[model samples]
Target: MDTDTPAVSAADSRVRRPPTADERTTLVAFLGWHRETLRVKCAGLTAAQLADRVLSPSGLSLLGLVRHAAETERFWFRTVMAGEPFEGLYAGDGAFDVARADERTVDEAWAAWRREVEFGERFVDEARDLDVAGDEPGEGPVSLRWVLMHLLEEYARHNGHADLLRERLDGVVGL
Candidate 1:
């Protein structure tokens, strides 16, 4: 992130568009809105700012949130939904701990997040129906609908964290 980075306008950040009639469409729209909210919260900040743990005694940072969100996407969409063999993004290490305030780290984290998002979108698009099933280890089969709802919940929770992180970093507020 950079101060000069193009700002995501308020209009673009907000979920003003009404969701379609389809359940899948509605769920996807909500999830996309949450994802964009996180990105907007992170926009125009430097790597150091992104990695700063504004809340003392807590290692939570915007950078860490983004990385964790990416991993969450991969775990649900690729590993569970697509039934693909998955490895942890940070080599089994906690995502927050690996969020360094360096150009390379920032670049890699964003790139990985974007890539996982793309894959998730593609998977959703190709699914025949919300009932489409994916096998989860130990949990047995889970429906696409369930996964979408879970993703929405996951993003929404983390986006709230992102909101606070942004406010602490720059006094910026609102989605």
Candidate 2:
């Protein structure tokens, strides 16, 4: 294990179960659950372990997934939902290209991911309703509801990838 890698345990995080009532509450809870699932999937991995592309012929790695998730959160929440001026974290290239096993890279990716998540939570909380819309570059207006749903789908898909990556890395399973 790299000395710079922080020890993490799956049990340290809690994912909220989807609520039975209220559209907004249920959506938020589900999103939170998916987010936590990603975190849990990534728990207890060293920086080098995270960067390993266990599945050959594909560039997918746990660290890359983290970076990709961060970029996804930033794109939907800050750029699409809030209409904030956006710039890609990895600049000209995609998130996966910037993924590295080094401590600095890992730290930056996690910080960016957490920051985007925090901003997303605040943006969703302050929205007047799920009907609140933002303009997409080519798709015209998109509602908060659509964004939330899209985010849920995005996280769920990536969590599946993370699951596979985690299993390949350490034989850990179930999240």
Candidate 3:
């Protein structure tokens, strides 16, 4: 667990930048920040490192976080926003847990996560400043503000995991 390498190497351009004013810039900045945070967490690790399950006995890994966060964005934005059905990438109902990893499977997992993040970005860009209420059945009405706040919460929780996992993988810690 001592890789001790920066996730964003000297050449990778996905490092964090300054955030903008919330009143003007929307929550996309915040969301993007966390997404990049996870990407950085997965940095400098091999495919085996990315898919390592030692963080949890049930197969949670940095790669799992990447996949989970992406699907989460899609679940909230696509299913909740566009009313689409859920056919998740890494989850199955009534299953014991997510699958044990293979190289090809983990690669697909990473791709699915990234694709959903991109899709969510497009959704947010189109919905900028357009407040809409959630119409998902059995859920209370929610504004875009609520959605954004929830996303921030989600990202924050995962970022904590990213911090610990990154630290465990390497000695690097702090923001």
Give the alpha carbon lDDT tens digit for every residue of 1-175 in model 2: 3332334766746655665769999999999988877777877777788888888878899888888888889988888988888888876546776345777778878888888899999999999999999987877899999999999999889889998998988998886
Span of ten consecutive residues with least summed lDDT in model 3: 1-10
Residue-by-residue lDDT tens digits, candidate 1, 114-137: 889999999999999999998888
lDDT per residue (tens digit) for residues 75-153 in model 3 = 8778887668876765453121344555565566666677777787777777746486565555766666677778889
Sorted by TM-score, highest first, which candidate order results?
Answer: 2, 1, 3
CA lDDT for candidate 2: 0.82
* Candidates' C-alpha lDDT: 0.82, 0.82, 0.65
Q: Clashes in candidate 1: how many? A: 0
TM for every model, in the order presented, reads 0.89, 0.92, 0.78
TM-score-superior candidate, 1 or 2 = 2
Pairs that clash in candidate 2? none
Which of the predicted structures, 1 or 3, would earn the higher lDDT when compared with the native? 1
User: Model 2: number of clashes?
Assistant: 0
The TM-score that candidate 1 achieves is 0.89
Strongest candidate by lDDT: 2
